[model samples]
Target: MPEVKRKYVTPGELVGKGRYNRTSNVYQIEDKFYSTRVGMAEVINDSLRVIPLTGPYIPREDDLVVGKIIDHSAFAWEVDINSCFSSFLLAQSVFGRDYSPARDSLTKKFAIGDLVTAKILAFDRTRDPLLSVSGPGLGRINQGEIVSISPTKVPRVIGKKGAMIKTIENYSKCRLTVGQNGLVMISGNPEGIILAKSALDLINHEAHTADLTQKVQDLLSGSNNGEKE
Candidate 1:
């Protein structure tokens, strides 16, 4: 995907000239498209549109997301996706039509304050994003330290599979969970989690390095020996 730089649209500025409502992205301006509100401009091929910096997260289909369970019922759980509206995961949506597991089990199907990883199945543009938990590798989180950072750095954290993630895992001997929106959860023994979290943070701060391998190795060794913070 080509990168789009975010800019600002001045008040009363007509960046989009389209006659219809274009996508919310600030980069594209067409006929009937004009600034609906004052906010950041998503630069699109020499044009700009407006969108508020603080807005509801509108989930697109297949978008991997991190959500918090705020409400629960015997049949479903409602998640606050850090968006304008909350989402819901029906029991069937999580376990599937035929998959069966005792609800009373301590597997943490979901409970208030529990964080979960899931795929956005659909966005009811009319409502909150619809998320699903039935897909492979989708389920409750186990053992991890949740760290926070700027959402823009997600792509850097998850370099090509995971070549970046793999490096962290190998060095820290821990598993890391990086939410696309910049919510990271690192899990392992206390020492391992700390090492993994710090290493990942290093990667974020120093992504410009062309030779990352040696630096990663050195960091791992230092972390293991408790050489420095």
Candidate 2:
């Protein structure tokens, strides 16, 4: 087994050589590999990859995301998924045959400024993302304030097996829906909402630090005590 090197890398920097397969945001020339983006490099076993610290969210199929309605056409509505590229939710995808432009207005169904939780149906670099609200846990979000964070920090917020997020919910007494695109919807008491937002901010600020789970736990515990006193 080869030792995995974990470190920050810059563009054009050598990642690894020979027998290591390169993946995501890196380029290869023969057996030698180089990074094409600025990120942290992770080498595990025979696989090597880069995790970008900053970049636009590249949509992937089946990704659950939170978005705001930005614009609408006769048959579809455009959504801002906190990415450089916008997504489209077709009328038929949401309303099926009940969507009738002649008798019903698209705006009335999904007006601008409405927040939604949707699933990506398809995505390619050349085309806008296709979204759907037909699955479980997918639909219009009527309440709660949305908080934005760096998309790269989503995994940290989620933590191992959802430990970190569950901690936030318990401490703040807020029910949260976290989107992979870095949008979090908080629903509960005003004080709990504020505490949840603060915890999320802490995660975003210290995602790269070690013992992050412990740090988030300590923060939540301290806040919970303050609320009781």
- After superposition on all C-alphas, the RMSD of every candidate to the true structure, in Å, is 6.3, 3.1
Q: Candidate 1 on 79-196: residue-level lDDT in tens?
A: 8666566788777776667644564432356768888888887776676677787766566776577886555456567878678778778877887777665677777889988877
TM-score of 2: 0.90
Candidate 1 Cα RMSD after full superposition onto the native fold (Å): 6.3
What tens digits encode model 2's per-residue C-alpha lDDT throughout 1-229? 6777798899999988878643777888998889877788888887889887777777889988999999999899999999888999999887787878887788878899999999999999789999999977788998887999888889888888998889999989998888999998888999999889988998888787778888778777774455531
lDDT of 2 at 163: 88
- Those runs of model 1 whose alpha carbons end farther than 4 Å from true positions after fitting are 1-58, 73-75, 95-108, 204-218, 221-229
Each prediction's TM-score against the native?
0.63, 0.90
lDDT score for candidate 1 against the true structure: 0.66
Task: Report residue 222 deviation for candidate 1 (angstroms).
Answer: 3.0
The count of residue-pair clashes in candidate 1 stands at 13
